[model samples]
Target: MQYSTKTKFFNKTLSVFMTVLSPVILLTSVQAKEQIPLSETRCLQKSGYQPAHKFSPEIREVTIGNQLFDSIFSLGVKNFSEYKAYIVCRIPVNKQSHNTEFRVKFGIKDDANYETAKKTKVTFFLDGQAVESQILQIGQIATQNLEVSKNNNISIEVTCTQKLYTLDYCPAVEFVEASFF
Candidate 1:
């Protein structure tokens, strides 16, 4: 069949539009997943010398160099040989017959002494079971995917041992962000 010049131009335009729009639509759809927050319950390990540090519920605006961050928990422990902080959050899941996978994204705030305190370790637990653990430095960001048959609670525990127990300067760990999709 023969077509007019206007029809031919419209067909070409439609083809180009689809080629450019397909990936954009797909990307937007993929990025639209709901992110659940897991920073409601905070627990700190008790120390022999002093009681555990309190978890600050107030979100503070922090600026490190050129980057700015909103931190939900700021844990600063001073005059201690070892410190531990725990952040527990319960994640709700759909009651499906099959298992589900969730992507957890979290980061540690950038500290001035992060380079000196390289021995700080952060462990992630799901349903009171250890899922992943890593030694974190300043400005370290991490992501992990967990597959479970049912919904459960998750926690991030940070442990740091200071080389010097002086009251001058102590190592600190700040939880900047924690969300799951």
Candidate 2:
């Protein structure tokens, strides 16, 4: 009976010591990854987008499509001619982390007044190779979980052409929730 009571006491004391020490250890490992904003690189060749591109004055916090996102960059309003936009972000690789990725939530801004694009062609490239391509429509957004390649470069290309039947006006697109994790 005495042995059992001593064993229980020892276990409780060890548990308390571990509980107190865990936070200090965990805090040292926890960190936020700082990422740079996207810029134009001719959308990474003609296969994706044209070299002529422009961006919003600054990165802004925007509430779009029922979600609040940070570091949102957008293009200025332009004419309804041939429209294509692109963003190329080169992520800094952490050699220690194995499964690093560049994650982003983006879509055409859901604007009813036609300030936002109705539909556009979106493509993703990793390490200068096409990985995913799709049509991003109005009131909707898509996410790309791009794994970091050795080059650590990820490019996003959004384009609009005359092929789309319904929507005639060329509207701007909003890039939301861009980050590296």
Candidate 3:
């Protein structure tokens, strides 16, 4: 049977509509954006003496799910008696969350194994107090400073509320210039 003009026109219109719609859908899908994790771009630097004899500790990173508690690769000690051992931690924004807290434990090690630490000469300060500070327990990029007496050697333990991330690495502790009497 021969088709009517009205029916033929309707079919043609529908075909053209679908042809145009399909390409728009495909093009829009191809232009979709991707989601990526937060990142940082900066470096922190500091210098100090230990004891002249170098003590390198094999530091390890601890992870709890996607979050990392410690971001240490290694800790070094030199000129042990000249100055106090201090841990200067720089938390980059890309590696931290807002309004979250993290805990950092400081310890002094006499051996490379980090089995026993001299806890007597160790003290933690947050902002400016002798007690364990809670500033790092939450999420926010900050620099936390903890000081320890220059024992033989030592390392700082860092932990955070969210997954620990790294932007850069630097010395954990430094010593002041000593005068030979």
TM-scores for every predicted model: 0.55, 0.58, 0.26
Q: What is the C-alpha RMSD of each candidate to the true structure, in Å?
A: 7.8, 6.4, 16.0
User: On residues 114-138, what C-alpha lDDT tens digit does candidate 2 reach at each position?
Assistant: 5444566677888778898877666
Residue 181 accuracy (lDDT) in model 1: 53
lDDT of model 3 at position 62? 39
Better of 2 and 3 by lDDT: 2
Q: Spell out the clash pairs found in candidate 2.
A: none
Q: Which has the better TM-score: candidate 1, or candidate 2?
A: 2
Per-residue error for 7 in candidate 3, Å, reads 44
Candidate 2 least-lDDT 10 residues: 40-49
Arrange candidates, best lDDT first.
Answer: 2, 1, 3
Poorly placed runs, candidate 1 (over 4 Å): 1-33, 39-56, 64-66, 76-82, 96-108, 114-119, 148-151, 161-164, 168-170
lDDT, candidate 3, at 166: 40
Each prediction's Cα lDDT score?
A: 0.58, 0.59, 0.32
Pick by TM-score: 2 or 3, better one? 2
Candidate no. 3 TM-score = 0.26
Candidate 1 least-lDDT 10 residues: 39-48
